[model samples]
Target: IGASAILAENAAILSSGGGDTIDLGFDLNLESPINPATVTDVSEDAIEGLKVVLAASEEAAAAAEASMPQELVDHLDELSVVALKNATNLITTSDDEVDIPPKPEVVPTIATITAPQQEQQSPQTLNADEVSLAPVAFDVDLSESSVKEKTLDEQTPSVRKILKFAIPAIGVWLCGPILSLIDTSAVGVLSGTVQQAALNPAVAVTDYAALLIAFLYTGTTNMVASAQQTDRGTKDMPRTAKMMIGAMRMSTYVGAGLGAFLFVFARPLLRGIIGNDAIGPAVFAAALKYVRIRALGMPAAAVLGSTQAACLGMQDIKSPLYVLGAAAIINFLGDMLFVGHSNPLIGGTAGAAWATVISQYAALAFFIRWLSDKATKTTNEDQPGVINLSDAILEMTSKSDKKDCNGKNRRQSFRNVMDTFKGKALDAKRKRSTLFQNKGVVQNIRESSFGKAIRRRKETTTKSSTDDDDSFSTRGFLKNRFTTRDLFKLPDAETREKFAPYVLPVTSTQVGRVSGYVAMAHVVASSLGTVSMAAQQVIVSIFYCLCPIADSLSLTAQSFVPAIAEKESSMEKSAAMKKMLVNFLKAGAIFGGAMMAAVCGIPMITGFFTPDQAVKELVNSVVPLLLVFFGVHGFVCGTEGMLLGQKDLGFLGKMYAAFFAAVPYIMLGVKRKALAGCKSAGLSSVWTVFIGYQLARCGLWLGRAAKLQRGTYIAAKEQESAAASATTNMSALLAP
Candidate 1:
């Protein structure tokens, strides 16, 4: 678990590389205090160069670590503790041979430390002047030659790219409510006869149930989105699809089981819940019937939702949009044909359900075809290979031997002779220490003290100093320390034959991307549910009608962020973020202002759609509030996209939950407490809370944006200054 945690952290840092270095404190027995000012050995250019390479290395290492089986990871954690102790002993001692230390028997607890206890045993601290420190940890070497540089402008995503993706996002968000509105319109136009009304009694409950089933797909979206952030593409998209399909199948069985129970006792349940209401029992029976049929579509709809999430994660929204648009049209026409311009009938409601069922199956078919093509492509890519432990040990031993040989050659060089021997003859030394004598000398040394010599070499090579040069060799060492190549190179089968047999399969995390269609549907449904599910649908449909424009702009925003993140180009990130925000806000403002104006100047603007006086009154009261929400809707959408990019779904979930819970409470309060409650207060208590909560959340999101922007600015400034300093230092070092 610790190893997994480390790998996750490393992945995040590498992906967000902006010239930061890993500050593992090894100088004090893995407890060294980080002194940023004191550590100045690396050149800014070299550090920055390493940042880019580290990004890939970190990703690879994370993949390798994630691939390890759970049991192996648990064992690895145990071995790592032993390794750390051995490493500490080697660093503290100065013998010429390697000595392995036993792992500590007792684990240290934070509460176990006291000031007096710590004071009794402390390493001498260098005050202001002393510099050198003993080696403490293994630093793998990765080749510096692997790093590459690219121009900010050339690599950054274009405005057009952002719009293309964002547009699809907007479409995904708006389509659900529009479809719902179409259903409502078609149903409302049907005959008002008593029998027809009875046939569609539980329209409200069944609609909510359908949406509840749809809500199950939100999890699919979040998972797929996270997968995409880590480079998992559409080829692996089906794994997510399959999982969702499984979940959907399970949900369908459950929904059907529940539906059956409800259908068997529909009359009694309806009476119990809505005792005095004349419409209750009939509605309950209709709801039970609707569920029995709709339950069959659940698994297919779930799979469709999963596929949509994966597509969205891949940033391909066009397919889902096309599929849903056609589905909506088909459903509308089906509704009209079954019970047009007259009383509702069982045939009409069933016809609508059947239309939806067919559409879901069609969408499922399309998703499967797309997934197959993606899988085929992924199968051909170069992927990580599995390695076992025995081979890894052999590789370590071989590398150590080569390193020892190189050290010997350097020590035997002319420069070393001049520094150590003065006028002593090299031939005399060779004669004094012959091959046979060397064997005798080597035999005298025990493994216990042998590690000291290795420690000396580590300290000499890794000690930080301001005057140090940036060498290709040093960069290579860093590369080897951090790269995926060093993750776990187990010994070959021949070597493993002598030790404990362990199995490890190389595999990355398999959390697949969410389906774009599912996510879109939820966003639309939830947004519509905000006001009153039905009214919410009507308003959202209107908003969706303007989606072509909103969607085009959103696509531009989505495409620009990934490149900006990769390049560590703050200026471009800021510019793109700002441009998207501004445009969205402007569009929202114009939209909200126009709608509000239309409501105020012409009250019938809302009344024309509904004859129910109460429904019209509710609409009149909430128009301004709804308009305001719409005006800022663009900003909300853009912010959500940003959140997606950051892989910060926890925050999104919290905010979403709060909004959902708060809105309904306010609406319910206002309806129950009419003029008397309002007369005591300046305005209706409900609307006040409603507007307040919306504005408050908007403020919170804005604050988040500001904090992120400030962080980006600071990072950019620091990197630039470091680069400048590196240039100056290098110029002086090369001066004759």
Candidate 2:
């Protein structure tokens, strides 16, 4: 501030000076000479000293100027003028402030800095506050966020979800029959008429047998699935395992019994159905051979069927598909190698039977392996040890832990040696030792990989009272994994009482269903000749192939109905049922439309089954009837499924019995009117009877479903009314 004041006074003095002199002074010394130290005091003496120095310098300058001659003065004046002009030029040329240049319209590349260049150019001397103020650039990763969003979408159920279950189930169910169709076609192409015709009854017998045992499959599936849904929260896995084991053992016995019956009575059954007068001796012989050979596979078939049903109940259709696909391949290859060859190892018809038998066993093996794997994985927590029968016997016979050579407990040297060899080292006190006695040895064993597994198994088997929930001991493991000792053991009193109502209905329903098929087959074999039966088989196979669309939906309904009924409120349950019914009806329409399209191309399709023109024409005549049958059957199937889901088996059983009783009459009527005069009735009459049966079935189911729906609505209304009445009574009592 002091130096600034002095400079200001000096600048004021210079401004008062003459213009030319001011210029000359500026040229001589462009800066102020006053020192900051001298100006610091700002006293009177300092000011006076500054004035005296300035006066002296001015006097000296005047004396020197007077001494100068006129010529010298003129020359100096000229030089000064020139220097001023030159200074003006330099200012104009160098100073942008004096002469401003225009900025370029476009920015230059050199002026544009990238993020990397800006970082490089930025000063590194910034303080913490400065650094924090700096802007940062980063790339945001969106993949993880996007994946989470997609996962949430997948977790929500939609049409896509329904199709996911339906499509796989349809494929799994269709694969077996489709394979059989292929086998039939292959056999037809290779064998004579008798051999080909024999396939009809043979297949029918085997199919009938399979269907008869289907109760185990269907029953197991429903029970297990329902149990799973109920125990979803509590996870009572032991009870579920027992149900499966019991069902499986029961299926095995039933299958074995049926198989033995079929095996022993194969010829008699074939003779009874086809009869000697109706068909050639060769056909009957072939049919008998096929039935007998095929019967051997029935046990395996039963096991496979039961396992398949269990898998379906558990919503695990993929396993069955894999198993079936492998079996189909084996059967196809067997058919190619064994059939159509004279003097083949098993002959033509019998070869096909053997192929079926082998494939069935192979399927059973895969199913067993899958079941074992599933059990091992699921029962990981607190699993029990497998009951060691030998150990149990040993424990029962011996009074002490120690055992002698003669299976007696004795504290002896020889016994001790044997115990040590068995990994049970005795103590110096001559006392019996545990299996894991030596700490060092036990530690060593535990450290090994195999020992770790043993330890795990041991941990699973051993249980404490406090750890009951976690316990899955060997007792349960053995019971579930192996055939029960009492394979034919009846359910416990509690279980029998619980399942009694369901048993009769389920049994009756299954029996009635099989009876209808049996009656249809009997009618076809007895009334319609072999050719018509063969055509019927072909058409029926095609019908089944198409029917799965409806059947799969039905199965889906059966699988889910109980869950829906339990979880939803009355209104919500009603809505769900309506939605299910509408969806199934739509699916039926679609399936029926597809069948109609198939009917249009019956000639080409029937060609695959047979080359005979008469058979082809007969198949075509029945195509329209088949179409009607499928359409009506689809609705029946859907309603049946809903009823089954609702556990309305009693009504279904009664309806099936009524239908079964009327089936003979229906067939007889069709025969009397349509087939009485003709030598071969063709398959048209047969399909007509079937269509009538389906129509009646559809009507009964629809009526029952409507009645159930109406009853439910009425009950809900009554409940609401009662609740309202109770509220009114309470309000009246509280009035002041």
Candidate 3:
């Protein structure tokens, strides 16, 4: 459990790369402070570099520990331990190694220190002159090879790369809107306003369900991305495939159950939501039928969502685009074939719902095919064999070297890994210390502790008693760690615990957002009369059409931020995240600006949706608020993306919960205005409040991103932890 906690704690650092304060487990304010300012043997760069790395990244202290020089890292690592013991009382292990608490889960600024005692006295400050800490964490390697020699361009994600992922992801986000637009245009062009208004409530119900299921896929994406980071370029493909398969199964079951519920309660849900007064009995009847049909697609939507998330986690954006594109084609064609001008037993809207369901099922089939094929691929082609994830876990917690039934893994060489995950240092002088013992391979600090541990398993070789080297190297390691388990099994508790931090916070956010959308459609806009609702639908469709433009940055942040968490240095990780954010924001800004201009300059854009002049005028009236929505929408998404990328889920969840709770009350005002028939109480006013919430959201998330980039949160958390450790007078190592 401690080992798992270490992985979870560092995963964020490995991914976010920046933490504010890194408690080096040292207390500088002991009875007599030893002068750290002047050291005889170590160069100033060595000590300064240590300082830079340890001020550490966390709670809004946007920072990551940079991979550094081996001699210095080793020297300081020993000093850190020495400093640790001299400062605070600690227990010695049987072998005399100090137990370093899993590196303080470096959360960036403003995080509450879960220190058992809040009143614990804070650590006394060390003067900079006394400490000689370096100002810069970057370029601290002090190796003869200077910064100018290393090409940072290769490290940064290029515009082409960002667009490659962002474009497809934007398409993925735009898929629903695009599909709905096809239905709206077809139904409105043929069936008229009454039929078109029916789409308002029905689409709301379906979209909310789709939004609510975000936890399934979003959690999978972050989990897979974290695993990829843990592998640190070892390319553990099987682990990834196994996780995706499990997530897909979970999503499928959840989706199916949600679909069944909706199918069973479709009528009551619609009637209860919009009530009878909103659109007349005809519109309510059509909406109920549409929702029932749409409910059938939830199971399919679930599978596709997870598949898309897995692919995106791997940074394979185009695949999701292709699947969504195919779905769109089916949806467009199905709408034409199934929906018509004249009403049959069920209405035209119901026919469109059926088309949507068919498209969803088609996407599901493609997703299933993709998953099976993806699962079978080799993780490392160069390596002759693969190691399962379960094998990886066993080695981390294993303390004994036991032989399997076949008598493989009896070799003494594979030893360091057993103690490493427990925060034990690699024995540099051991006869077969595979970690950093290759004659001149002194780059110890270049790889994360976890990264080094993972590599030990990757290059493992097993030997048997009878034949010196005949035993299978990879197979031996697997057996030594634990018995082979079914590869298709779900991720165990430890793995899910890692994912919970990333998923739980966002779960509330999604639910609140879903509630807000549902309220907007039913409680807020429903009673505004048929022409008003029809015009609202027209505006809504345009909003969906331009969604790709607004959503591009958010998707880019989601795809790339966590993908590059394994960079050698905290500086590089921080720079990389910032670079991606800057580039993505620029793209979002440019596209969003273009969208606003197009809408304002081209009012005739409404002509495509309807022949009725009344609907066009109403749509035009809301153009001002729509512009604000588009202009601010992109930035909101981009900021949220950045925060989401940082896994600042707790913050986002609160904001979203507040917004969700506010939706009903705020919409009540809109409902009253609509009842009183205020001229401004139409779509424009309703959307104005939404735009305000989005703008507020954008400001808040951006502030968070700034704090994360600065790593203030990280520094504060460490200070709090250090203080608590000192105050509590805890005997055990500081809890991670």
Best candidate, lDDT: 3
> Candidate 2 lDDT (Cα, whole model)?
0.59
Global CA lDDT of candidate 3, please?
0.60
* Candidate order (lDDT): 3, 2, 1
Better by lDDT, candidate 2 or 1 = 2
For model 1, how does the per-residue alpha-carbon lDDT over 552-594 read when each residue is reduced to its tens digit?
Answer: 3333343334434533544455554455455545544443455
The Cα error of candidate 2 at residue 23, in Å, is 91
* Candidate 3: 10-residue stretch with minimal lDDT: 119-128
lDDT of 1 at 406: 34
| lDDT against the true structure, each candidate | 0.42, 0.59, 0.60
For model 3 the TM-score comes to 0.60
Model 3, span 554-582: residue lDDT tens: 65666566655433334445555567667
The residue-by-residue lDDT of candidate 2 on 574-634, one tens digit each, is 5555666666565556655665676667767778777888777777888778768766665
**Residue-level lDDT for 224 in candidate 2:** 64
Tell me how far the alpha carbon of residue 363 in candidate 2 is from the true structure, in angstroms, after superposition.
1.3
Per-model TM against the reference: 0.46, 0.60, 0.60
